[model samples]
Target: MNGKPAVFLDRDGVINEDRGYVHRWEDFSFLPGAIDALRQLQQKGYLLVVITNQSAVARGLCTEADVLALHERMCAFLRERGIELAGIYHCPHHPQGSVSDYAIACACRKPEPGMILRAAQAHGIDLSRSLLVGDKISDLEAGRAAGIPSLYLVVPPGQDEDLSSLPGVQRVSGLSEVVERMFGSQAMPSS
Candidate 1:
């Protein structure tokens, strides 16, 4: 990596509660320790990039403007907590989607590396030195495809405990654990 390492975050489950088709600010809720973890990462000199898949736009559950509004609110909230997002990218396509224009499969989806690759190019990021924090298998795959060396999978609340079978990825209970693993205990500020 030319610069400091980066942490690419998945929006829905990693940053906010994965309420299905979350396009409205009213439905957004930051998960426990999310903002704190982000601030920690930021303090450690890690660029924070949010990469998400908003297929709900394709399903017509919400419009692109709604998604932008939601992101604006999310960014503002994070800024209030002293956390700043380096960049945000979201794919608004889904195969077999309800909306005719957005129904086709696209390269920016979770399983695809398009979004990550684009972010890397835009920000001059080195994927091999960066990490990805996500809550799903697709996120891991996308990170792998983008050549990121480390992938941290967040186990959702009430989900099964087993993670032994998730290959080539590290499983963490939450974003705090991820920060500890990536930045180490010494990287944390005194509480």
Candidate 2:
């Protein structure tokens, strides 16, 4: 397949509420308008891929199976809304993790770009034509390292960090604002 443009999304905060270490499906809640925003991007022919850091697995708060189960449920939920994700890549490793198997510095972790790089290669994505939306600086760093041209930082409610220092990164309130920035002032209908 010839390369195609994609939108790399961060799971927590950007896709759902970052309710610390959310492993159970019950705890997972999609941020308002996330589904619609993703659907709009999909309709525009951009592959939707999720690149996330599931360090809870490494910290022993949850197992890899648990994370996979949550992802399955999340994907099913999106599928019901006509939004299909091309791929979901997660890093279950951390340097100071308690789980012996996962307690090591890994390339796939955010700020490293391994997951984004793998997704690009796996899906034949054109990094130069793709965009990334994430809530953390590490997420943008990974996107930059992987050569994504556009980087959007979603600042969730109740948290405010001075991001004026980061050049080339666009700050957005949420997925709704992201869609607005991408498609202009016209409003998108929710699914």
Alpha carbon lDDT of each predicted model = 0.87, 0.92
Per-residue lDDT of candidate 1, residues 3-48 (tens digit): 5578999998898988898998889998888888899888888889
Instruction: Report the C-alpha lDDT of model 2 over 1-191, residue by residue, as the tens digit.
Output: 36999999999999999999999999999998888899998988899999999999999999999999999999999898898999999999999999999999989999999999999999999999999999999999899999887999998667786766668899888888988888885655765
Ten-residue region with minimum lDDT total, candidate 1? 157-166
TM-score of each: 0.92, 0.95
Any idea what lDDT model 2 has? 0.92
Error of 1 at 47 (Å): 0.6
Candidate 1, residue 151: CA error in Å? Answer: 0.4
Off by over 4 Å in 2: 185-187
lDDT winner among the candidates? 2
Off by over 4 Å in 1: 161-166, 187-191
